[model samples]
Target: MIYSIFTALSWGKDLTHLFKRIEESKIALAIFSGKYAQSKWCLNELAKMKTLAEKNKLKVIPIFYKVKVDDVRHQKGEFGHNFWKLARTSSGEEIKQWKEALEFVSYKMGLTLCENRYST
Candidate 1:
């Protein structure tokens, strides 16, 4: 089974269409992870999706991305560089938000690093 964790923007843009495809695919499950999914507009849409999925007995998991400091700097190059720019220009509140987003991405990247390091 192929699981998908599409972003919030992607969901907003084509959720109905994508969900339809997913239903047709008859996959085991579909997972989505994003912060925007928490917004009021998105939440309502999510509810509709949930209802539809439940009606068809489809499995859909939504994961919220949380951030951490220790892992944020792991990808210290292009991607990190862009984040750095945002970090520099962001207001205190925005920085706080970005930090959270970065943490999630960084932690996943860290896991990738660990796997590669231990691979023989």
Candidate 2:
């Protein structure tokens, strides 16, 4: 099934509305995209979506744009291209938030959501 970006990123605006639409629709994946998603507020909102999906037993595929692959790194200072510099520049708070977000999404949703398909 096809889902519009408008509905995907409607967590804060109208998450229940969006979920109702998703439940009625046949879409296996939904893509959430927007510039506002880069903010901390959006991150918390996504955690909410994961909760909604779990409670409803729905599978959601989140699609993000403008987040370059080279922007993220693993704890071993690996993954991203500029690993050394990125690790050095990233503050403890930033890293903690990133890890916490990752853990929350993974534990709550039972899915990575990120495009880590190559890991398999």
Best by lDDT: 2
Ten contiguous residues minimizing lDDT sum, candidate 2: 68-77
**Tens digits of per-residue lDDT for model 1 on 1-120?**
222433332465755665554454332221222233223333333444444445765544433223222423342444345455555654676455444433433333222223124210
Q: What is the C-alpha RMSD of each candidate to the true structure, in Å?
A: 10.1, 8.2
lDDT of each: 0.39, 0.41
User: lDDT tens string, model 2, 20-51?
Assistant: 65555433332223333244444444444455
Question: Candidate 2 — which pairs collide?
Answer: none
**Candidate 1: worst-modelled 10 consecutive residues by lDDT:** 111-120
Candidate 2: global Cα-lDDT? Answer: 0.41
Candidate closest to the true structure, highest TM-score = 2
